[model samples]
Target chain A: MTASRFSPRRLAATFSLGLALASGAAFAANEQYFPLQSYRVGPYAAGGTGFFGGFIDYMQLINARDGGVNGVKLTWSECETEYVVEKGVECYERLKKGLNGAPAAATNPLSVGIAYATLERSTADKIPLITINHGRTDSTDGSVFPYVFPLQLNPYSEVSAIVNYIGQKAGGLDKLKGKKIVTLYHGSPYGKETIPILDILAKKYGFSVTHIEVPHPGTEQQSQWLNIRRIKPEWVILRGWGVMNPVALKTAAKTGFPADRVIGNIWSNSEDDAAPAGDAAKGFISITTHPAGTDFPVLKDIDKQVVKAGKGNLQDPKRFGNVYYNLGVVNGILNVEAVRIAQAKFGKRPLSGEEVRWGFEHLNIDNKRLQELGAVGLVQNLKLSCADHEGGGAVRFQQWDGARWKVISDWVQADRALLRPIIEKSAAAYAKEKGITPRNCAKEG
Target chain B: MDFFLEVLIGGLLAGVMYSMVAIGFVLIFKASGVFNFAQGSMVLFAALTFVSLLERGFAFWSAFAATLASMLVLAWAIERGVLRHLVNRPPITLFMATLGVSFIIEGLAQLLWGAQVHGLELGIKDEPLEFGGVLLSSFDLFAAGTAAALVLALSLLFSRTRIGLSLRAVADDPLAALSVGIRLQRIWGVVWAVAGFVSLVAGLLWGARLGVQFSLSLVVLKALPVLIIGGFSSIGGAIVGGLIVGASEKLAEVYVGPLIGDGLENWFPYVLALLFLLVRPAGLFGERAIERV
Candidate 1:
């Protein structure tokens, strides 16, 4: 036994194992891990792949150019959710623990259903769960949703921004008086989330609005379009998703409604939604937090550094600067900036999930920072706090011209003053229901 | 009255599309008692293959031929790799197997062609065509014509061919047909290939309408009520059942839906299907099952 222990092979193997363990520890100490609950195959896979691909590509760019943010390397692993809520929860449970003893930076599920399902679990785990442009409207109050970030815009803000844009087009809010509008929405909680907000806005602006629902998956919408023809509203707000968007545009055409009069919401604004409708989708406009196209300096850098080097995550190069991909890149920028902000407060090593949550709450990316990041006009200026999770209540409008989207408006800010009170009321109600004592952001400041 | 007629006509035209999908199910069910749950995946697979090819610069006819070949190959693989192994399995077992196959095919379709939405152009503009004060979609009219031609061809194949006779015999009783020297495997293979062809047609039309994406497979949900109302075993039943489901659901969504909160088209067909099941489980044109219990 003694002679065996002293063997040359055994000694070499032990030495190698020790060296590997030491390096692994060193690697873990200097890394910020992001647990990506990504979907690459499902009904929503097109959106998922583009978004996650953009996100991963942005992170890859960071690693390639900056060698990590402040000497802390960015690392991530994806757990495919297929856009299913249960699968998302499973992914959350599987990946809440960071890799190789590194603390997880955050979780970006990208699905509203998954985000809602894991809200409590994410809070309990003390990890930040980022829902870029969609989530519960009440979750905007970071006091109650400390671990959840609705990022740039929440549901209420999205509708408000659209209404504001509509107002801007109508000459003024007062001019919208007596004007009739119809909202064709998907039949889900997400689609219904803005109903009250729209109603409030309608009443406030002296406009009459009609709401029509399209069932889930929304394939056949002839009846709804026929009804829209009957109503003859001046504008049709298409609050749709997946196959519903193109179907709405096509049906609107069949029903003799001008495509230019249809205003798609954030989810309905993608090239995937417009291109399918062909000529019917011409001149169709939608709201966006970020514009599509690789003309932005950030996108050009990504194409040059990440994609050209074969380190890009997009399976199809055609989707490199599409709407969803741009949203993902914007999302990646926000997440990384949050980590950088947190590192400034706490030391520059791999921080825990709670520390990262604080970073997200304090995320402030103004026009100066956007310019510095070479993401001007690509991402809206955002400033988050414990009282407000959705910092950027603004959107730009774009129109589809048969082949691609052309930005048609500058950043149109939502009436956040009008929306803030409503957001607080809902958040307060939620806090009372959950028996949660709201955080004192004043003291945190 | 004109508005009502418009809704009714639009719905009936839409029903033709549902009938197109149901025809694929009817083909498989009539020949082999298996429900072939992978039919939707086949549609997605075919459309994805065709559009991906088109994007890669394949001509229209060339892409169509290649997609048809792929579907036929898929039919052969399903018969050999799946249905062949479970020749005499229970209907439930076959259904479960096909359900598993559906997931595999969906994954494989996305894996083979990257998960990206591609707009399919069939060259038929979806512009409105007015007829007697009622506006109808020209594209929908083209779809209706295609459906009519497909149904007629399928009807002829089943009624006026020796292979059709063998298929009918096998459908009636596999053991008896096998004893009489009707190659059951060959009939199953032929029926599946024909179903595959139907899926290609359905896929092209649907892909053109909805864009070729993962959601293309979700049209299966729309066919469920049609199948239930028409009975899974009859192609003609599928057409009649589709018309009933389509027109009634649209009319309901427009007229009755407002009274009971709208968006009833999705589930109203299921209600009608349930009523049909209660009254006539064999469907309008389906043969009555004479099982000796």
Candidate 2:
């Protein structure tokens, strides 16, 4: 046989050797490995880039400022999900493995559909999955979902807060008796989650609720908005995501609906969504659990340390002030706090997935904690015990004034008294479906 | 009466947008046997280039001219690099090659101008104009006029130009056209450039309608049903088919939808196109090609 420069066997051997060496380097590093399921390229990329950019920037900020949480470096590998569930699954499978034969410290699914798909797998793999904003609402019931953490606001709480804000807008809770409200939502589980609560509230408050579904990547909404125009709803709530939010806003504007009366859900209320609509988004109200803008001290630190030092992921550091970006920073802070809290118990040497779970279970972020972290008013006080994964979130209302979002309402708390039974009912249904026994909150640390 | 008129006008305008994209498909399919699946990706790429160039401080017209030049280069490269090698190959092979080209273009667009949704404001005001008590989107109306102008221009080119005759001859029979001194390569290059122009207009209209994002690539899928309703090889068919699909779906959704469920507009067009397919296999304007063994 003639000798060749790149024989198949030799090439295969070289590729294998390269992988071995690369994996060895990763294993040797004294760093905490975090696999980020980021969606930086899709219809949702505007939101994704802002949020994911903030996420990576804050992680970089942590590594640079604090010398890694408790002297251990934070190592992260991002896999793009593109807001598609199948790609999310592929990303999850690809990055589930960690350095030194460790279970992945944590994974952020970032999407509800992806979270739903990975629920069983993550439980089996024993990796603590963190979904700060959007995920399975029942996952907040830690008795059933041991691995998943719906940190900030579950859909139920979010919807109630939105409803409360609407009540506040309508003058009072009792004043909403005859209000005609419509919810233009993205047609997915994320969008569908808000419907049940709306239906329940409609009957209770005597408001005629009509929600319209916009299909995925909703660019076409002429007919839907025309219907909204005909319905003449007093208030139209937008439970949309990705490009759908702006499209809904624009279409609603085209249909002659006033911007202030049309409120967007937390997912729909961000700089990414409103900026696209431009003047059409002026006075558009939306619900948020946290404050927006880069006015926070921690964000300044990130800008000073990470961006100024040229270690930040954002191409434009000015995007650091966006609503989604601030949310991302909050997500990173909660994650790092969980690690720090976990370190106190697990001896601080690159925590296992299980140790991270314990830390998340015992998590508490009161105003005092937020101030200490330099994030004071950016986030509302939160506590996540073994029973409540959501930790009782409250949402504030903000309205876009053609430029920046101005806070319109105070932190209106969700009626946990109402949400608890609903949460337990669904969580019990989930437990029964999966043949899972409820974790004894008293029995575990 | 006003509601009906408004809905009808809206649908027709929406149809005009669909026809813009469908014309790109028909141009490629008529000139060459390949169904240009890359038309959507081309629109996305063109929009990304146009927006990014403008963002980089190029004047509006300068950005437009630069985008046009880049699209011409892309068309030429595609014809030279992909189509030239696949000459005389099965039409399916060429279609698949275009699909590959689309994937390549999508990746290239994302790589070059990072994946972020950009608002391509082409100075088209989106405010609804009240036309005799009926609400009409000025932007959509302008887009419809643009599509009409484009169709008229394409017709004039075909009926009044020697290059168009050569294209028709090449499309009719490559071998016979070659015998008559027509260059197959040149015809394909012009056809691709024409299709590229169609994509740019469609991109500007759509990028203005919805901000430019990866989702623009999927908007091309809507044209498939349009092509099915209209014939794949006829420009007139594209306009008529797009109008039919658009009008019927809107009318149906507004009147007959809520009884079943809301958002019937999503699948109504496909069902209408499929039903039309069953009645006329050759499509509304397609030539009936018969094979005898």
lDDT to native, each model:
0.91, 0.85
Give the Cα error of residue A73 in candidate 2, in Å. 1.8
Over the stretch B1-293, how does candidate 1's per-residue lDDT look in tens digits?
99999999999999999999999999999888888889999999999999999989999999999999999999999899998999778999999999999999999998999887888889999999999999999999999999999999988988899998898898788889999999988998999899999999999999989888888888888898899888889998899988988899999999998899988889999888888889998788777879899
Q: Which candidate is the best by DockQ?
A: 1
Mind giving the per-residue lDDT tens digits that candidate 2 earns over B17-90? 88899999999998887999999999999998998998899999998899999999999999999999999899
Off by over 4 Å in 1: A1-28
Tens digit per residue, CA lDDT, model 1, A219-270 = 9999999998999898999999999999899889888999999999999999
Return the top candidate by TM-score.
1
* Residue A53 in model 1: lDDT: 93
* Candidate 1, RMSD to the unseen true structure: 4.3
Clashes of each: 0, 0
Off by over 4 Å in 2: A1-29, A101-103
